[model samples]
Target: MTTMEPQGGFSYSEADFRRVQDIARREAGINLPISKRSLVFSRVSRRIRATGRASFRDYLDYVSGREGQDELKELICVLTTNVTQFFREKSHFEHLEAHVLPQLGEKLRAGGRGRLWSAACSTGQEPWSMAMSVMAELPDALRMDLKILATDINHAVVETGRIGQYPAEEVRSVPQRWQDAYMEPMEMEQVSMAREIRRLVTFRPLNLNREWPFKGQFDVIFCRNVVIYFDDETRNALWKRLADRLVPGGFLYVGHSERVDCIRECHLEAVAPTIYMKKG
Candidate 1:
């Protein structure tokens, strides 16, 4: 195989690219195709510079070693995409507000516990949006047994979620009603989520491809825009695991481009575009 010319002052070979593909698949269950070769070079090259490695081979060797676990994590962090915003894919949240929250609200108001999981919750927006939606219907949700769990594979983004702060512009995508009620202004044109809203969400670092620590079914699970990186087998297996984690009649919202092909096997039924409901 012809070696690709060096870019960013680092040599990247087809063999090096294959190494990255193998590591990404093994470490994160991500599938990297030839189309991602340039992407791999561009992103991983920075890691090379940061870690003072001479070339892609050196960097790959370092990350592949037994003592390279931390660098390996950094590599995964940079390679994985984390683009997200408040109320992204508005339809999902709208459906949550209109259909899901009402039933959960009733249960919570009747002194029952409810849980929502924002798997791959990038930067806390999705779970915070969920908290707001729950508050909209149940104003006293903070006093209820309902809560949202926000998790991400990247520890950095998970910390950002735990902090519950975002730039003012990022919060604009949030509904004005929610903005006013759940957000407070900060210096530097940033906004911090109100304690009430933050209190309703628990942020933790979680790798979806790995074992889940806690054991409980969710009333709603938002694993949106995440599985697109996985190959069919990994994606299908993840869908089944997610389905198993849902309470009967629970809702699962995914990315618009993603579909749950194991609906019958998982006891899930499509209820809307990118939404599935576990059968009762």
Candidate 2:
């Protein structure tokens, strides 16, 4: 068997680098070719050093084995970038409040089930924003049945989302009216998501690169600012997979800077300003 050595007081064998790069490509469609080797090391090497493995091979072996898959996933979450904030994309929230929720609520009141999904929802801000929009459109008593699902690859973020508390600065940009209506000003000086918004969202761990785990269908799917990391094949596959969970003619929202040039065949329409709707 061929053997390798470490460097930089931490030997990173060539094969070990290849394996981790493959893992990122397979899991998130993020191709970490030679140019991104440094980025990979920046994200994962600290953990390898912490494990005292002294070799990337041993680290890879531990992270890739069946019993170690969870560890691998955790590593991916840590290495991946996740930046989120309340109302980060203001127009989308306004679209939901002014246009989407009213229409979806009418259908739900007519005995149709209604749900919104924030796929690739990094740190819970987007889905919570959806929840607030939904609640704002519906009267308080009639809001009990509506729910929004928020999912991300990171288990840690999912857990943090459920707690619905954040540093005050993280929520400062939220409109003052929304802040007053949907957040509890805590004595601890942090902002807590009000029960109205909190109860409306269901946070779950999801690997968007894998099969999505939700049951039934959703009225809308907001998958913004995520497809850029994925390759063309993976992005198309995800589009099809996500469509499987949406009602016909329901809305699908993608990030502004991301789009497939040939998505017309998917029966989607460039409806509204930045939203696409599946054709019936």
- Mind giving the per-residue lDDT tens digits that candidate 1 earns over 37-102? 999899998898899988888888899898888999999988788988888899998899899888
TM-score of each: 0.96, 0.90
> Which residue runs of candidate 1 sit more than 4 Å off their true CA positions?
none
Question: Candidate 1: which pairs clash?
Answer: none
Give model 2's TM-score versus the native structure. 0.90
- Cα lDDT of all candidates, in order? 0.90, 0.77
- lDDT by residue (1-280, candidate 2, tens digit) is 3333344565665676788878888776765667666666656777776666656778888988887787788778766767888876787777777877788777777777787899988878888877777766886524445778898888888888888888888888887888888899886678989985677788898888776654778889998888877878888888877777778878888887877444566677777665878878
List, in order, the clash count of every candidate structure: 0, 2
**After aligning candidate 2 to the native by TM-score, how far in Å is the CA of 143 from where it should be?**
3.6
